[model samples]
Target: MSQIPKIPRRIVTGIKNGRSVITDDAIATNVSEHFPGLIISDIWATSQMPADLSTEIIVENTAFPVVPANGSYFRYVSIPPDKDLGIKPLEAGQVHPLMHKTATLDYIIILSGEIYMILDEEETLLKAGDIVIQRGTNHAWSNRSDTHCIQLAVLLAAN
Candidate 1:
């Protein structure tokens, strides 16, 4: 199993006193431990309805309790090689243990290493610089390499 790398802390810059300033800097929130060798960093998120803003905001919200409608979420995910997810396939229809439907369009980009995009009876190998547009489909990610894989995903809530 590959070890988790020392990921850099996140930094948010905002206007303070009519000038740009460092507002917040820390790791991501809403991280899930459901999968082994998997690390998800919730970067940013927004509400379904737009909030009335009287002033400029740096980081409006970072919580991801649930995916909002008409909003979006930016996330960072890392998967280690030869991960033992212990996920079993679903019996009803074609589904994976990590497979779940979403009401959003996901833009997935591979940053480093290699991974497989698992679907129902199908798999696609993705490498660095590869991109996948997941249209709210049932899918999962698997790292079969001997190294760690990093990916960035942007999920946009769809109607």
Candidate 2:
């Protein structure tokens, strides 16, 4: 089996001694492989809006809920090609096994390679540098290309 590449380093900035400074700079350690070739790295999270920047931030590598209630989530995902995972393109009236919905508005950026954003009744191809504003919907990500696709996602809690 091939190893999943590490997500890019994270540089967190904050105020120290009343002056802005780099507080944390390191690779995120809260990573998981939900599937054979699918990897997810939780980079950061906030428990509330107007995030509390008064204290030093510490990212705990604990198992966090996929969608934080009334908060935000930042993560990177590496999706392996569908073929490698024994997944086929969706047919009419069919739903991918990974199809699901969350109550969070997601901002996704295709950082590398390509992927298909599969919705309930339609699918669209997205390449590197493409952005997707996924508003709480039933969807799935399908990598039809021969290479893995990397995406950065910021999810904000929504009603």
In TM-score terms, which candidate is top?
2
- Candidate 2 residue 152 C-alpha distance from true site, Å: 0.7
What C-alpha lDDT, on a 0 to 100 scale, does residue 54 get in candidate 2?
59
Clashing pairs in 1: none
* Model 2 agreement with the true structure over 41-108: per-residue lDDT tens digits: 87888778877665433444432236557778887888889887788876778789888888889999
What pairs collide in candidate 2?
none
Ten-residue segment with the worst summed lDDT in candidate 2? 56-65
Error of 1 at 40 (Å): 1.3
The number of the candidate with the highest lDDT is 2
Misplaced by over 4 Å in model 2 are: 1-3, 55-65
Q: Please identify model 1 stretches exceeding 4 Å from their true place.
A: 49-65, 86-95
| TM-score per candidate | 0.76, 0.87
